[model samples]
Target: MDHIKKVGVIGSGTMGAGITQLMVQNGCATVLFDIDKETVDKAKESIGSRLERLVEKKKISTEEMILAKELLQTTTDMNMFKDCQLVIEAAPEKIEIKRSIFQQLEKICAKDTVLTTNTSSLSITEISGQIENPRRVAGYHFFNPAPIMPLVEVVQGLQTAPETIEVLVQFAEGLNKKPVVCKDTPGFIVNRVARPFYNEALRIMNDQVASVEQVDRIMKSAGNFKMGPFELQDLIGIDVNFATTQSVHASFYGESRFRPHYYQERMVQSGSLGRKTKGGFYNYD
Candidate 1:
């Protein structure tokens, strides 16, 4: 497996910043890109702060943190990704946005540069459908808190080459993430298996069977899970979680099981999007 030395992450949002931090910390020269200069600059600051925290905690030395920071580069220009051996599209989960990014990347990067999407539920095949090299396009879904999350779903689109899957699996492992290969499917694996977890919790609350806090408590204690569905939703962003449910539901052709609850939609509409917004199922403020 070829080792990916230089990586590019498109979008400087939460996932994008986390991925950039992870790459640089793992010794890869990383380029973080966003259309907005301010957003990208803030992301770099956030990444730096996180590394400082790790240094304070003794997880990494001062030298290591300095080296990681040195390896990171932030840019508002998409053309800066030309030299990246692997470019992960951590842009918004919208299919059109992802398609446009991959299309643009195809023109900017080398033919063999692996173009991967961090979309949790969007169809990888559809996103890369119009790209010149569909085989190089695959889904590289990472959980929230990319540096800490161990599981990475390596999704193979219908046209994704076997070599592409192999490269991604190796790259993911190189980053110390556990990679699971799966065919293109709605919600892939974790999100699909976990959809009912959130939906049912919302249903129970909506039906007055339990309060939000009560539901989370029960799941953590009874289910032996680290976090309850509602609490997890708050961390993952209500809008993002809701969008995944909607995507899976549509992919399954309105399957009742994957249906998104209106309460979640209402939270999104209300702009109570979770930790970032300081409010969601539970208030951070």
Candidate 2:
């Protein structure tokens, strides 16, 4: 862990920004990369504003915020990752895009530099299959709002080296997150085990068995869940949740247990993609 000082984060979007913030806050020099300068700049601004709010609440000192901002850098070049000891790719959930990033990273990164993905649905083994050193590729799945989410699934691909997993587990711990090791399986742990929550709720709603609010209330009251399925889907982005369900269902060869509901797809198509879009199951507006 001592040797893993400089880190690189690809994709300066929501998850990328959060992960970069986590790395910098924990005293690691982090480089945030994106396709263009504009997106990177916006992400930096958003992260800076968030850190300023933390300073206002005394969650972090002004000096600490300043240092974190300084420790974080934004880049439009993949070559900037040349010096990174660890690089986490948090790009969009597209396999081809991830494959291209890994291919480029292989050309720029050191042989021993650890590479991981923040993919919640994609297969880690498949993502690393074409890479020069598949041994270093693993999954470092973080939930939405990465800094606040405590659980990080450290998925070990079929070809991933044990030492790579050890370093990532330690790295996640360094970020003050709980790490769980799992094999490279579809949807990994949380997403795979949690399929029923959203899928069943959608089924119930579609079958006219219960309203979204009613189901949410029952789950919170009876199931003791902090938030109901619809609520969680909204928070996680309905589109993102839909993609996961679709991926898992396809991975299982159309297993009925993991089949996605049409209602969820309708929400995604309607652009009611949860809290991010101000609407999903329950309207945020």
Candidate 3:
């Protein structure tokens, strides 16, 4: 893939801010965008604090951290992204919201510029189709804490060009991330493969096979996972997790195996999303 010197990241949430920090740390000028000025300012502050912590831990030199912060620009204008080589949208998961951002990005960005979405659940095929040049649009889903996560899912939609995927594979690798190319299906790879983990765990709990704590312990010891399903769910946000499950389940047209459990729905419905709220399936409070 050709060199990507400038990156535009839409949204200021944990995922988006982390992406900006990582891109800048890798020597790319990153422009971060959000709808509101306050959100952008908060994101900037969050990134600064994170970098400061890294410096304190001796993970990065203080000078390097300052340079990384200098490389990051925060903005609310989509027009600012016109010069970006690759623009990654990390906006909310709503399809309409993403489509709107794509429409705006297509208008502001050049024809050769690649438009990528960091959408974990939605279909890249559908998201790309909403834009003018679907061939140039693709999924570039990153795991939570993008700066630290090793894996990146480089998904190609039905109409995505091979060169686009190739570009991203190199791009992700340059960021010190392992990129895995996959066809843009419902949940793609990791999400699909990992679905049964959460679903079956819920099923087992409901069936009295084990309690949530026992299931987590067993999975961690025997399954060799850093975190069990319930623990991971709490960390990822129950609402966000449930939404992804629902999206995948819906994308599969209500396949029984992909069905989301009501217990998760209850967690979301009750507004007990997760760690952000200081509680979830396993209470943090």
CA-only RMSD, every prediction: 0.8, 1.1, 1.3
| lDDT-better candidate, 2 vs 3 | 2
Indicate the worst ten consecutive residues by lDDT in candidate 3: 123-132
Show where candidate 3 strays beyond 4 Å: none
Give the least accurate 10-residue stretch of model 1, judged by summed lDDT. Answer: 1-10
Give the distance in Å from residue 141's predicted Cα in candidate 2 to where it truly belongs.
0.6
Winner by TM-score between candidate 3 and candidate 1: 1
lDDT of 1 by residue, 1-285 (tens): 356788999999989999999999999999999999999999999999999999999999999999999999999999999988999999988888888888899999988899999999999999999987899999999888999999999999999999999999988888889999999999999999999999999999999999999999999999999999988998988998999999999999999999999999999999999899998988898
Task: Give the CA lDDT, 0 to 100, for residue 243 in model 3.
Answer: 87
lDDT of each: 0.93, 0.93, 0.90
Residues 1-285, candidate 2: write the lDDT tens digits: 888999999998789999999888889999999999999999999999999999999999999999999999999988999999999999988899999999999999999899999999899999999987899999999887898889999999999999999999988888889999999989999999999989999999999999999999999999999899999998988888999999999998999999998988998889999888877777777
Model 2 off-target regions past 4 Å?
none
Candidate 3 per-residue lDDT over residues 150-190, each given as its tens digit = 99999999999999998999999888899999898888998
Q: Candidate 1, after superposition: displacement of residue 187 in Å?
A: 0.5
